[model samples]
Target: MTAAPVKNLTLADFLHLPYVEESPAWEYVDGVLQQKPMPKTRHSMLQKRLLTAVDAATEDYTALPELRCTFGGRSTVPDVAVVVWERIPVNDLGEPEDHFTLAPDWTIEILSPDQKATRVIDNILHCLKHGCRLGWMLDPDDYAVFVFQSQRETEVFRGDRLLPMLEGIDLSLTAEQIFSWLQVKRR
Candidate 1:
């Protein structure tokens, strides 16, 4: 759903809008307010499992789910946003800051059945353009992962092929292994 604004709303206007925690996330892209589709069962499951896996595999980085990051004149909520430990913003008290004013080091987007792939890819590209090290778009139905990095051709990994990871991240995951997380009982 696109919110109809009486006039073209600027990023400043979007930043001032009331944020409701329970509502579907609203993203500001290209001066348009776009509502992300509610996550479905597969999407939710994959997001949860992937987040858990990434978190467990890295000590130098943190993976947060549904984090809203603002940069390059856009606000986006990636399925999983990974930031290097030292790069995470902290308050005066040393606690993590509530708002991110920059792109994540690594952005992950899970493909929802109703979501447009182009929009998702656009956000990833935006992050890359803003100095993000890596991005991954996971397609559950296809059991594939589309990888993006700075100055590199996009690659699709499937089955047991190892998916790319940010530098210093020792964990290795395959598209099949990721999609297997959705199965409660493995064959």
Candidate 2:
């Protein structure tokens, strides 16, 4: 027997569904769904390193990995999500949900070569507007990072400077160090 055709679901409908085990490659934007292509090796490595460093630095807090969150009907899975320890919600059993409903305190996105800068910037801006305290857009090719804070201005860092948001956290990696990690060695 032929199966019934599935209807295209809106972002609202998507959220009502059960939680997914694996993070999907789709993002919801303005009531429409968009697919993100698989990240390249450099993109993947940078994302992993950033997540590791951020988690290590904020060990006192409750940070999560690729957690699904919604902001104004848009569902985005940020590369790394830092949730302030105190602000974390407790469940009936006195445990926090694996996924968060609100925007994270910090969101970081590593731009893939094929991804559009405007789109990535929009995501950062969206996070800021929705109460995210900090956001970072790392450009692998240019070795630059664009930092954004809610209710504040945006800043760009290049070369050998430490990021401002990471000041209290004491992260000392420079742009050169970040890019160098992406390089492959010849045997």
Candidate 3:
């Protein structure tokens, strides 16, 4: 027995349809629709690491994982988002919904081989413009992290030193330490 074929649909059509368990992953860019790739192992590892670090630093605050958020009409699934606990809205059942309409306080994106740098940068900028306090783009190949803060210059970290962002939260891991974790063999 064979399964039924799925139809190729536009972003507009995809949005109008009810959310399903097996909805095709989609991203909208300037009114154009693009499919996102499934993350690879390296990408997954880095995302988990970053999430863990941020979660530890922001334990007192509410942090969401892989939540679909809409900003500037561009719905995206950021790897991780940190929201102040007080800002989260509770439904009638006193539970948070799966989707969030508000911008996150912080957004992080891990680069995949198939993803374009320019597109990722655009997303980061979009987040900044939408009141996101901070954004980070992690490049696996270069083992570098780019930090963005609204109305401030972007900072690039390539060595072993803590990347700044967290306030009142103490974290000591540096950029070099993060990249070193990607290595299978250390010199």
Best by lDDT: 1
Supply the TM-score for candidate 3: 0.82
Cα lDDT tens digits for candidate 1, 1-187: 4554436788888878886234578888888778887889998999988888888888999899899898899989999999999988899999988889899999999998788899999999999999898999998878889999999999999999988888778788999889888888758
Instruction: Rank the models by TM-score, top first.
Output: 1, 3, 2
Candidate 1 lands at a TM-score of 0.93
Structure candidate 3, residue pairs in collision: 159-176, 161-174
**Model 3 regions more than 4 Å off:** 1-14, 18-24, 184-187
Compared with the true structure, the alpha-carbon lDDT of candidate 3 equals 0.72
Candidates ranked, most accurate by lDDT first = 1, 2, 3
**TM-scores, in order shown?**
0.93, 0.82, 0.82
Candidate 3 lDDT by residue in tens digits, 74-150: 77667778777666777899887656777788888888888877877887789888888888888889888999999
Assess candidate 2 and give its lDDT: 0.73
What clash pairs does model 1 have? none
Give, for candidate 3, the lowest lDDT window spanning 10 residues: 1-10
Q: Which portions of model 2 miss their true places by more than 4 Å? A: 1-9, 16-24, 166-168, 185-187
Selected candidate, larger lDDT, 2 vs 3: 2
Candidate 2 residue pairs in clash (backbone atoms < 3 Å): none
